[model samples]
Target: MRTLRFLLQKEFRQILRSRSLLISIILGPVIQLTLLPLAANFEVKKIAVAVVDHDHSTYSNKLIAKIYASKYFSGGTYHSSYEAANKMIEQNKADIILEIPQGFERNLVREGHEEVYVAVNAINGTKAGVGSGYLGAIVADFNQDVRLQWNQPGHFSEAPTIDVVNANWYNPFMSYFLFMVPGLIVSLLTGIGAFSASLNIVKEKEIGTIEQINVTPIKKHHFILGKLIPYWVLSMFVFTIGMLVSRFAYGIVPVGNIGLLYGFLSAYLITLLGAGLLISTYSDTQQQAVSLAFFFVLVFNMISGVFTSIDSMPDWGKALSYLSPMSHFAAVMRMVVLKGSTFHDIQPHFIAIIILGIVFNTWAVLNYRKTT
Candidate 1:
């Protein structure tokens, strides 16, 4: 314990004395946490639409008005022909085209049916799908309105209606920022704990400082713990900054127990730092360490259910994802923040990280050789 304390002091002093690195380490992530949530949003909006209206009828104009009025749509300029509207899609000026056929109102009023053509630009699949879906819903709502107005009380027979009352539990407004902020925080934290920590240790080796430590009478675990401790504390400080940004800048407040989130974070950081040290133990240079660290963290981020769902992945991918510490941390953050998950509810995640901590630290300790 005494030896670990002295080593930790050395590590902290080294980190603090470097003003440039210290600023970059602390300020860079703060900027990311503050700005990323604003741009990394998943909600698709302001989709450009084009309309081909051959009817020029009352209902057709009303439908066009409704499409343009929606929050999801913009710039639904009326065109002369379907071919002209299709040109807008090709030029990327419009994401989707709504073609209202001639005699549309007459067909709907007299025959009770008419087909309105919808053409979506599949170049950007997600935007196309969401924009088209939004248009389809508005058209359906318009159909319901027109049908009710045209039909008298005795002309229509009522059927059973199934209304879905969608209650968005944690995020009432379904703000994508609420869901994404926690995951982004975890991602930033992981990069700091893993990539930056590994780079730190390798930097010591590059400067011949690690050689001086290796010659001392310190226990292997003591040396490892010393390397891990300073960064561990700094990680918590960074985490506090991120949480503050999440709350004040983005209006994100975790609904779960803050203590529980901290407990999980403490466990997760230990394992991540250990993995970083394990990489540094084998790496000869800081470049090698940073490259390895970046590769691993990037892979973990891609597979960690941050931007996408894990359940949507294939069987092999899911199995591999479980091995990543990031997957568990991301899951824990979302579960606690969004669902208010309890300790018992997150047993599997907590245990997985602890187990990972043991494995990685043990590997690092064994790999770290002290030469006389």
Candidate 2:
């Protein structure tokens, strides 16, 4: 225990002695927590819409008013025909085109029928889908109003009513920023800690200090714990800064218990640091250790569902995703931030990471040697 304490102290002093590295450890989390949330917004608004009012009647004007009144749409301009609207859309001026047929109101009142055309650009399928849904809803609402005015009290025999109640727990708004920011924080910390801690041990090996330590009476576990624990603490500091930025700067409140988050994050830190130690066990140069650690982290990020949904992936891909620490961390983060998940909700991922941490830490100790 005393040897472990001494080694931990030495590692802390070594980390603090490097001014540039300490600054990176402090500021890297800030940049990730701030920029990533601001950049990753999924909700769309102010979709430009063009109107081709062939009728040029009060009814056409009323329909245009309703379209513009909707929060999803913004009025681009009035066009004489579909050709003109198409020209505007071709030039990227409009996302939706509304064409009101000639004699629209007359047909509705006298013939009991009128038709309107809505053309939506489907180049960006997501935007088009959402915009089309909004336009369809507005048109349906207007048709209902017109029918009500025309003495069609129960048009569908029964009052065709649709009731939708959506409940979004944790992040009720489903803020994309809130969901993604924590994951970005995890990615940044993983990259930094893995590279830095691995480089520390590898640098000692390259310079012959590892031999000096080996010659001493320091137990293998004592040396390993001393080197790893300080970085683990440093990772915790980076994580705390990330949490503060989430709360104060980005308004990302974790709906789950803070203690639970911290606990899992601590486990995650050990997993990362242990992986770095394993890299050090294999490599003698700081550059080699950093490069190898980066390769693994990059591969982990790609497979981790950090930027994509894991549920959308194939079974083989999903099976492969569990190999990454980021995958488990991302899953746990979503549950904690979005579902307000308790320990029970995240037990599988938490247990997997714990098992992974133990396995890697064991591999690091077994493979690591005092000599070359």
Candidate 3:
């Protein structure tokens, strides 16, 4: 216990004495917690619309009003002709173009049907889909309202109609910030653990302190442990801060067992520390360690689905993600944050991490040697 405390205190002191460590530890989490959530959302809004009304009647004007009133669409520009609206769409000024044919109200009143043209930009497929749905919904509602006014018996018919009681489960209303903050936290922790931890040790070796340590009574394992304990503690601290920020900024509450989370996180940090140690062991200079760590971290962050969905990735890319700790961590984090999955629900992932931790730690230790 005494030795452990001494080691912890010494490591803390060493970390504090280094300005770079202090900045990365503090600013890294802050930037991730504050900025990344805003940048990683998929929600569509404020789509520009254009209107072509040849009818010049109250019905055409009302239809245009309906489109503009939709929360999904911004106010539309009035075009005298479809050709004019088409130019606006082609110029990227309009996301959707609507055209009501001439004599639309006359056709609706006499024949009970009128045609409306809707042209959408297919370049952004998802947004175009959403915009099409919005336009369709508005027109459908208007049709129902017209039916009630014109065809209803005293406008109070109680017929069996299919009413959709749409309810969103789990992350209801889909707060994008809540979805992204946790993933950013994982990315930041991996960067700090993989980069900063190795940098300090490699610097020591470059400056000849490692040579003196080799002649001391300390074993290779003990020396590595002593070096890693500080960053392990720092990583845990950063995670706690991230959780607090999640609750306050994103209103994200963890539904999983907190004990299980911390337990797995403990093992996860060991794996990350092993990676840092492995880099330090192989690197003769701090520059090499930093460059190699940066490359690996970038690859891991991209493949891990930090900003994108892993489900969208190809089978081979998804399968290769097993090699990345961030991939596993991001999955578990999102599972806990959104789905409220139990440890039992994540057992396979947990077991995989355990095996990976053992393998990385063993490799790091084997690469580590003491020379007198």
Each model's TM-score?
0.97, 0.86, 0.88
Q: In candidate 1, list every pair of residues with a backbone clash.
A: none
Candidates 2 and 3 compared by TM-score, better number: 3
The candidate maximizing TM-score is 1
The residue-by-residue lDDT of candidate 1 on 35-112, one tens digit each, is 888898778898988888999999898988888789999766779999999888888898888889999989988998
Q: What is the C-alpha lDDT of each candidate?
A: 0.89, 0.84, 0.82
Clashes of each: 0, 0, 0
How do the residues 1-372 of candidate 3 rate in per-residue lDDT, one tens digit apiece? 455566668778888898977887887788777777786668888888898888989877777787777788895798988889999989999999888889998998888888789999999998899988889889988887776767767666556689898777876886777678778888888988888777867887989987877787766667777888888888899888888887887777887776777777888888888888888888989889988899889989989987777899899889878878778888888888778889888888888888888888788878878852
Writing each residue's lDDT as its tens digit, candidate 2 over 1-372 gives: 988877877877888999999888898678766887667665667788888888888877877899889888975688888999999889888898988999998998899788889899888877888998998989888887777777655655645678788898676786777778888877888888888878878888888888899999878888888888888888888888988888898787888888888889889888888999999989878888878988998888877887777788898878888877879988888788767899998999899999989998999998887655
Give the runs in model 2 whose Cα sits over 4 Å from its true position: 110-115, 152-159, 205-208, 214-218, 284-287
lDDT at 139 for candidate 1? 91
| TM-score of model 2 (CA atoms) | 0.86
- List the RMSD of every prediction in angstroms: 1.4, 3.0, 3.0
